[model samples]
Target: MEQKREISDEQRFCEMRATVEDCNRFACALFQQLSAQNSGNLFFSPASISTALAMTLAGARGETAQEMHNALQLTQEGAQLHAAFQRLLSETRTGGVELDVANQLWGKTGYHFLAPFLETIRDCYDGGLQLVDFQEEPAAAADQINEWVSRATHGKITELVSPMSFHELTRLILVNAIYFKGAWEDEFEPERTRDQTFYLAGDQQTSVPMMHQTGSFGYFENETLQVLELPYRKRNYVPQFVENEDGSVGLMHTEVPGGGGDFSMCILLPRERDGLNDLEKEIDSATLQTWLTMRHQEVIVSLPRFQLELEYELNTPLESLGMERAFQPSSADFYGMTDNPEGLYIDAVLHKTFVDINERGTEAAAVTGVVWAAGCAQEPEPPKVFCADHPFLFLIRDRQTGWIYFMGRFNQPEHQAD
Candidate 1:
């Protein structure tokens, strides 16, 4: 008789891995939504960002410890998942946001197991998240979130979120977080950075402080995209690139060797520096997704180190990016912990991010939090595009995972002016 073949535990583990991968993809979609909405830079090492979001969402929903571990695929040796959540929490606290608020939103279902995952990783982040309760007053939460958004974006983004009344039994609050950091990729000599003419549209130009450098770099070009690499002053920081295909110019950050580090791409459309109206209209989730898929046949790129500090809020853009379920109280499901079926549904999802690019490379941080409600409600605006006519930067990232966060620019200055 033929011997019976048994299914091995590793095989079972593969099935589990498949499930985790699906969840990972879902979480990545959410992050991509958040990133696209803000038109800001995002960075995450490996699966850190995705795992953090999944663990938080699972914790908020009252998932069992086993369920959380399974969903995030937390292995004993790799602290990737734990490290990511810790970084996020740390960043939030750094911005003076209360941890109690995060717990209130996450602890609703008594799923405290997930809390440790967040608490454990809190030390890695450097930002903040604030909670605004709307039940006490109409639009109070929205107003507070809006203020944080304004400040986080350095006024580039304004009024992205608003409070309203809805039918859900849970009262709602808005959670917001913001961070800022500056680093040198290839630190410019103080003498090398000087005022130079930055060409605006047509003949218009403005004198801006520009940094200059010349070094042998990893260079490549294709019909559709031009690629140039500029390594940071810290060799540990990988090089970044710029790709201009057709009219849309974007920053491309490729996957680092050995599959480590953060990867991102930024697309800038020039608009009046005063407002984001024009920038908003020209780009949406679909526009960004399409850009990612566009074929670049041949291209050339060269980018020099310059200084930039960018800030943007993600609430409005996230909703447009297809995470409506998490923000909607009725659609959100978090009833596992308490008997009060309507007690702790997510009321709002708010995020703020900031970054400063200089010679050191890119050093930045962001924080995101979800608010719960006793019950609720709910926008209009003409969109705009910031034409990115000048020497602007961009990065290309893994849309599904945000794994390799890289940065680069579309225009290179001819010389550094004094």
Candidate 2:
């Protein structure tokens, strides 16, 4: 008899990491498509935006691969050929820009193949991304996608799509879908949340709800930055913090020191809202990676908490940013896979996200064994005042794979849901 092979814990962990990585890559491609279409309206860095796209792709249906190829006029073999074509496209570009090739392929094919994925996402986002597929009439697909954008984002985002035309021989559809909903771990009491003065830049201030709290929580501080962890009403929802050297703050996914298990929420509440612009200009992939590897010393953090909800539609923005080749049936040459290749084309890509942050903590809570950091400092530091009043970018990412699950900016807070 053959000996039974046992799966080790590390092997299981690696498998999970792969699943998350695949999802992240797919979603990042979709995000690239969105960014390509909408040029200047977004706030996150390109890499952060890519991570958000990865998060969305995690929710896509497994059948999407087959459906997408069929719509594009490619067989499994043909799709593989198209992928090879993309590889060649990458080789043609110089420097890190080569990665843009992946984004281009996603932008082109993601939109066309996204119908079914959108349908699944609609149910996930509470009736967002509704597109009526009239088999007999076959109305303009762009129009349908636009309608979904209008309804899902509560009208904050309009015209996510435009009229499109393709050669009858090459038009193919690819679908990308995403679904995310997170609540605070500690619930903010509506009564406790009171309108307080929020300090904006340049001696500016706005009255906003400032949720107050004091508890034994995860905290860290250093000469360059201060850190804090605020759990939502749900244990699963924990937002981490990273205060910068200049007193400005930003949000980051909290990971275990030494690269252990999953990630936690970390939001860097910058001292100045406008400081984000300068901060963004200085940020690059390497900067972020360096920050994560830093050794933190004795730290304590206290933060005033609040709640927020946000949603976005990112298709139109992606196409306008130099990725039009993938969407064009004539220009798209995905014929390497099958002999019966009439040519493969792409249709559309769609994404939706929901998050609620409050004083009570996150809505989804998960209890797990905590890994203690050895020789770390104790004692909470005086809480730095950080409030998100103006426009700011946010992202959700997987700790292990550095995959971004969601990315968007909160431009108008009033439009957010409860």
**Best model number under TM-score:** 2
lDDT, candidate 1, at 174 = 29
Off by over 4 Å in 1: 1-52, 59-185, 201-203, 233-315, 336-339, 376-391, 396-402, 405-418
Per-model CA lDDT versus the true structure:
0.38, 0.36
TM-score of every model versus the real structure = 0.46, 0.48
Q: In model 2, which range of ten residues has the least summed lDDT?
A: 366-375
Return the lDDT, model 1, position 331. Answer: 59
